[model samples]
Target: MKQSEIIKRLSDKELKKQVFLSQGLLLIVGVGLSFIFFDTFADWNSIMGWKPKQILFYGVIPGLGIVLLDIFIMRIFPEKHYDDGGINKRIFKNQSIGFIFVLSSLVAISEELLFRGVLQSVFGYLIASILFAVVHFRYFTKPVLLLSIFSISFLIGYLFEVTNNLYVTIAFHFTVDFVLGLIIRFKL
Candidate 1:
């Protein structure tokens, strides 16, 4: 199928709601698995780079940089921005600052916990990144977007390895989502 047709189907309100529901579920699943299978969230705080400067360098800089790069790419090829993976544009626009914070926090925490925290622990970085990319199934319709997701996931995995802090990955993820979420909220 053409990318346009797939994006058209994905943009429907029902599909957007489904994605929202699934992301909500991701938090539960991640926490549940962490409790049931793993023993500790201890290593989640094992920050090799504990200094604020390091955190900014490793997490915030790359996080913001990638988001900016995405914006540039999306601007250049406007159609590439169609890959929302079912984020409800209307809900995004309607959300206030506090509410958008909560929503964006939820997204960052849930996905990072599962993919980087849980899965990366078990499967290692490369495999976990591949799984993470695969879970973003909508992007597959556009190979470039799929590649982008995989590459970002890999980078996040690398950051997690270096910092040994789940929060760093969460920060990166949060930065991207919250910024983009706000942009979508206002722009559209």
Candidate 2:
């Protein structure tokens, strides 16, 4: 069966379940990899720094900027260019605001922890950014979506590199996913 046909066959509950399962796996892998790679808790703490200013500046501000740009693109471009087998809509459209927040937060934390915290820390920015984009394999057939994800990945990785804080990237990822998920939920 074609990909869209497969997507269409899956119920929203199943999609949400798969999403949760996948993110849970990512969280496990991220934590496991961190433990394997870091020599001590202090090493992990160094990268997982907590600072309000860094979160606000490096994360929230840039995330909002990317959302605005995405909104602009959605307005100008055809919907087909941004399609992802309707997965985002199926996962988010009927979800409650609280559920959206929770889902987005889970995704942001797990993905950032794995991609930026573990992969980028060990392999550097370029590889981590590329792997991040590649992991969103569904976007490969859509050039615009692929490029957008790649650019976003690169930006998030850069933020981690500059701030040397996983929290910064997590906040940024959360901002983007939360706001976008809200937009989807509300059909905005």
Scored by lDDT, the top model is: 2
Candidate 1 Cα misplacement greater than 4 A, ranges: 1-17, 40-51, 80-82, 85-88
Candidate 2: pairs in clash: none
Per-residue lDDT tens digits of candidate 1, residues 74-148? Answer: 778766454554444655776677766877788888999998888887779998888888888767777668778
> Model 1 reaches what TM-score against the true structure?
0.81
Error of 2 at 8 (Å): 2.0
- Give TM per candidate: 0.81, 0.97
Per-structure clash totals for the candidates? 0, 0
Cα lDDT of model 2 by residue, 1-188, tens digit: 87677778888898899899999999999999999998899988898778999899999999999999999989998989988878999999988999999999999999999999899999999999999999898988888899899999999999998999999999999999999999998989
Candidate 2 regions with alpha-carbon error over 4 angstroms: 1-3
lDDT of each: 0.76, 0.92
**Residue pairs that clash (backbone atoms under 3 angstroms), model 1:** none
